[model samples]
Target: MEHANTAQLGRGPVTSSDLRRRQNGRLASIGEPLPIGMRGADAGGREGRSEAPLPLILRRVHPLILLSTVLMCLATGARAQQSSTATYSVTFQGNWTTASTPGGVVGGAHFTTLIGAVHNDQVTFWESGGTATAGVERVAELGSTGTFKSEINANSNAISVIEQSVSGGGTGSATFNVTVTSDHPRVTLLSMIGPSPDWFVGVSGRSLLNTQGNWQSPIQVDLFPYDAGTEDGTEFSLSNPATSPQGVITSIRGTGKFSNVRMARLTFTLQSAIPPPTPPPPPPGGGGFGGGGGAPRTSAPSAPRNLTAVGGDGEVVLTWEPPLRDGGADITDYEYRVDR
Candidate 1:
C-alpha cells in the first residue's frame, strides 16, 4: 500500500505478472483497466521507491486481450444504445391492411408493423420532392430489404449508424436487430407498414433519461407513418411507373389532395446540453436576402416552455409562449422534428 500528500498513490511495480496474479484471484476482474497515472514525485514521496525509474508502472496489457476487451465493450455499448444514432432493422410483423398505394385502406388492418430506420437530425423517412431512396421504395413496393442497406449508407450523416430487420407476415414475430454508433443512446424501435407508399413507422429522437444500459421492457410508441413525401405518393413498381401511380397527395402532403393523412401530430424531442442552435439574425434587411422580404414579419421569437410526452394515448405535446416571429396568425400550427 502507498500513500501520498493528498494527491496520488499506487502499489509497487504493477507489472503484467502482478496484474495476472491479482486477476486470477477473482473471476469478475480479468482485463487490465487503464490505471490511474501517477508518479511518486507527484504524490510527495507516497512510496518508499520514490526514485524508481518507471514510477508509474501500469501493467502492460497483452495486445490481443486488450483488443478483445475493447471490442467486447463496443459491442455491449452498441446493443445498450440500440435506439440512438444507429440503424435498427425494423420488420413488419402485425397485420398490415392499409394500401401501399394511393388507394384507401382496403382491409381491417390500419398499418401495423412496417419496417423503418431512424437517426439523429437527418431522417430516413421520406420527404417532399425527393422520391423514396431505392431502399425505402423497395420496402414500400416489393417488401424487399436488399437495397435498403445501401441507401441508408448513402443517406446517413457521418454521425449516423444503421441497423435493420424484416419478416414476412405469417405466424411468428418478424424480428430485427437495431444497429447504431456505440455512443448515442436515446433512440428506440423503428417500425414500418406496407399498405402505404412513403408512409412508415418512425421512432425519432427518444429520451434515454432513465434507461442507461439494460432495457426495462418495451414501450408502445405511436410508430406514426411519416409521409417522407418521397415519390409524391407511395407507389409500387409498375410494368410502367404509370400503372401503380404513387405520388398523389392524399393524407400525407395534403397539398395536392387536402386529405391531411392527419395521422395525428407526432413530436420528437432531443434533449441534451446541446449548444444553443445559433439562428442567423434575419438576413440583412434593406433588399439583400432578408432586406426585400418586407419588414421581416415583426414577431416574437418562440420561447421554449414545457415539453410533455403523454404515455398510453401516445402523443408528444409541446407548449411554449408565442414566437417573437408571430405574424398574428394565432399560431395556427407548429412543426416539430428531431434536431439531432
Candidate 2:
C-alpha cells in the first residue's frame, strides 16, 4: 500500500505491473475519471514492461460508475437522434364548389397558387381575427405567393415553403416535400379563392408531432374559406378598393360565405413509410437530343377545340381543349386574340 501511494504520486519509477496497481489505487482514492488513453504499460512511460489490459482494469471499476457511464452515452445518443432532421411528405387538394353568391357575386371555385411553410409554433403567416399582413393581402387580392414565401423565409424557425399553381372547380391537388426538425414541427398553408375578391383558404400552425413528441403519419385536415379583409369588394372582381382600415381576418360566413361548400383538404404523410417521387423511365428508345431516331414525327396538330371564354370583374378567362394533331411535335405555346 505504501509503495502504491508513493508510485501514484510519481515519487519513484515503477514497472508496468506496479503502475497498474497504483493507478487503480489512485482512482479509488480520488474518485476521478481516468485520463483519456492513460494506462500502465500501454501508456509507455516505462521500458520493457507489459501493461494491464483495459478490459481487466474496467472490470475492477465500481459497478455504479460503469452503469452511469453507459447511461450517459445512451442519453447523448438519444438527444442526437431527437434533434436530427426528418422529412415530411405534404399534399394539398383543392375541393371548392363552384357557384354564385346570393348577392350576384361569382364564386367559381378555382384555387390560386398554393403557398405554405413548415415552421415553429411561434411563427405565424395569418391568423383568424387578426389584421392581414401585406403578404396575405398579396395572395388574397392578386393570388400571388411570392411575398408570402418571403415573409415565412424571414422567420428564424421556418423549415420550408411551397408555392405552386393549383386550381380547380371542385377537385384538384398539389404535392410538396420538406425536411423538418423537432424545433420546427408545424405547417401552414394558404391559397386564394379565385373569382373572389380577397378570399382564401388555408390551414395554419398544424402540428406534426404527437403528444408523446413522436412524428405522426397521415394527418388529414379540412380547409375553409376566409376573407383576407384587405378589400371591400363583395364579389370576385378585380375592380375594388383596399379597405380603409383592413378589417379583421375572419372565417367566411354570412350569405357570401360558402358555408355548405368544402374548400380544400390537406394531408401530411411521413416519408419514412412512403418513398418520394422518382424520375420517369427513359423513353422507348434512349431520351434527350442527338440520340437514336428523333422523336416519332406526327401529323400537323389540329387547331384548338372547344374554345370557350368567361368574363369576370376586369379580366377574362379562356378555356379550350388541346389540338387533336400535334404535328409530330409537342405544343410549346399558345396564341390567343382578345377582341374588345
Candidate 3:
C-alpha cells in the first residue's frame, strides 16, 4: 500500500501533485515551515500542525558554532590585510676611475664584493656618524664579507642579504635580485673601495616604499665615499695604522684628498610583485542561519596529469598536462628537480 505523502521515484511518470506533496512532507519532517495554504494540513487533506519558522531554527544553533564562524572570518580578513612582497634588481654601478677622483686614483682600484640587507627601521646596518662595527671595519679595510654576513644573519630585523661583486675593474656593474616586504622595506648596501685604509661606499637605511605605501621603482642613488673611521690613512694604497680610538663614520667628500664627485651609483628597478589575497565577503544579514558568505578555502593546485619522459642521447624530454584544479589563483610557475 502506498503512503499518503511518499515520493514515487522510478515508478511511473510522477505527477506535479506528487512532487508538491513530497516536498511539503520533507519540510514538515525537518520542522521547517510549510508553503502558503499547505499549513496545518497534510497532502491527503488530513489536519496536522506545521513546523516552526526560520527564527526557531536559528535559535537552535549552538553559541560555539556562531563564535567559531566569526573567528574564522576575522582570521581570513587578517591574512588578506598582510602586505605583498616586492622584488627588485639592485645594480651596483661603480664609477671609480681617475676621471672621477682625479689625483686619488691608484692602480688596481676596484670595489670589493657588495654586501647588504633588507631590514626595518628598527635596525641600521651602518650609518654615518656612527662607530663602525668589526664587520664594517673588515669590509672597509680588507674587503671581506664573512663577518658582515654573520652580523646580518643574526639580526632578527634583517630580511634578506645581497652579495655580488664586479669582475676585474674599478668601473663596472653587478646586479642581483632582492625581495622585500612592507615590514622590511629599508635597504643598506656597502662595498669597499679597494687599496684604501678604511674607505667604502654605500647607502644606509634607504626605504623602497614611498609615503603612500607603494613600492618605488627605478630608484637612483648617488654614492659617495665614506671613511670607516678605523684607519688613519689619507691616501689610497697607503700603509696606515688604525686610529688610537675608533672614530665615527664620516663622509670623505671635499675632505682634502677626495674630490667632490660620486664614486658610484645604485639603481633599483622593480622586477615582480605578489599582491596579498583578497578577503572573503561577510555573512549575509549580519550573520546567523541562512547567512550566505564564507566560500571554500583554496590551496595548492593538484598534481599534473599524464606526465611522460623520453630518454635521448645525453638528454631527456619531458611533458605533462596541466592540473585538473588550480586552487583559486592562477598558476604562475612550475619548479622541477632531478635526482641522480
Candidate 4:
C-alpha cells in the first residue's frame, strides 16, 4: 500500500488506478477510457456530452510504459531524499622520553585512558592479535587500555576519558574527537602502542560528507606493524635499572626480527551527502536521463537498503552489523553507495 507513484499524479488522493500505478507499476488494467462513442462533436476536437476526462487506453506496448515509468521515476527520486552526514576529530599524541625522541615513537611510564573504547559509528577498539575481539588482553598484554575502555561502555556504546594523572604531563595525549550531528553518517578511530605489547593504532568504517555544513574526507595513509600474541617477551624488571629488557620479546612467531615493523604515512579525507530537494518526478517515460543528485551515478546501484549484487545485474551490494568506534576495532570498510 505504500507504493505510491505515477509521479504522485495531481499531487494527492489517488484512484485513477492510483494515478495509474503511481504512474506505472507495470500497468495491466486494459479497457476503460475509449468510451467516447457518442459525444456528438463539441469545442475543437469536437465533443459534446462532456464527462470530463475519461478517454484512455495505454496498458502497455510502449516499453512496459518505458520500464514502469523508470522504476517509478527511480522510486520517486528515492523518497525525496534525506540522508546526509558529518562529524570529525583525530589526535593521538603521547609517549615521550625526551619528547618522544624526535618522533621515533616510544612510551610507557604511565598515562592511562583507554577512552572507554570509542563511541560513535559503532565502537571499534583495535584488533590485530587474534586480530581482535574486544581488544583482548588489554590490547595484547599491558600495552594498557584498562580493559579496553571497559568493553566500549559494556556494549551499549559511548565512551570518553581524559587523564593528566595529576597534571604533570600537562593534560596532553589522547584527544580523539568526532562530532557531526544532523542524522550522522560515518566515523571511527583507535590507538595502542605503549611498552609495545600488541602495538596498535587504527581507523576504519568511514563516510562523512557535507563539506559546507562539515564532515569532510581527504585521507592518505600507510600502516603495518603488529605482534601481540600476549606476554612472553621475557624480561626481568629490576635487574639493575629496574630492568625489563634482556632479549626483549615474548612471542613474535618464527620471529623475522619482529616481522617487519615499518610503515606510517598519512593523509585523510571523505565528505559528501546533502539532503533537501525532493518531490520532482513526473518526467520518466516522457523525458529524463539525469538531473539531480548534484553529481555521481552512472546508473546501476539502486540504493537505500537493498543489497546482494556481487557485481552482476548492474552491481549493488551492502552489509552491516560489525563496527565499533572510539574503543576501536577499526571497522575496515562499508560505504554502500553515495552515487547521484
Q: Which one wins on lDDT?
A: 3
- TM-score for model 4? 0.26
Give TM per candidate: 0.32, 0.53, 0.60, 0.26
Model 4 lDDT per residue over 245-336, tens place:
21221233223323333222223333333444453444533211222222222332332233211212322122222322211111111221
Q: How close is candidate 2 to the true structure, as a TM-score?
A: 0.53
* RMSD to truth, every model: 24.9, 26.2, 19.8, 17.9
| Model 2: residue 224 alpha-carbon error in angstroms | 0.6
Model 3 is weakest, by summed lDDT over 10 consecutive residues, at: 70-79
Give candidate 1's whole-model lDDT: 0.33
lDDT of 4: 0.32
lDDT of 2: 0.57
CA lDDT for candidate 3:
0.65
Is 2 or 4 the stronger prediction by TM-score? 2
Query: Candidate 3: where is the Cα deviation over 4 Å?
Result: 1-81, 282-340
Error of 4 at 128 (Å): 9.2
> Candidate 2: minimum summed lDDT over ten consecutive residues — where?
71-80
Alpha carbon deviation, residue 84, candidate 2 (Å): 3.8
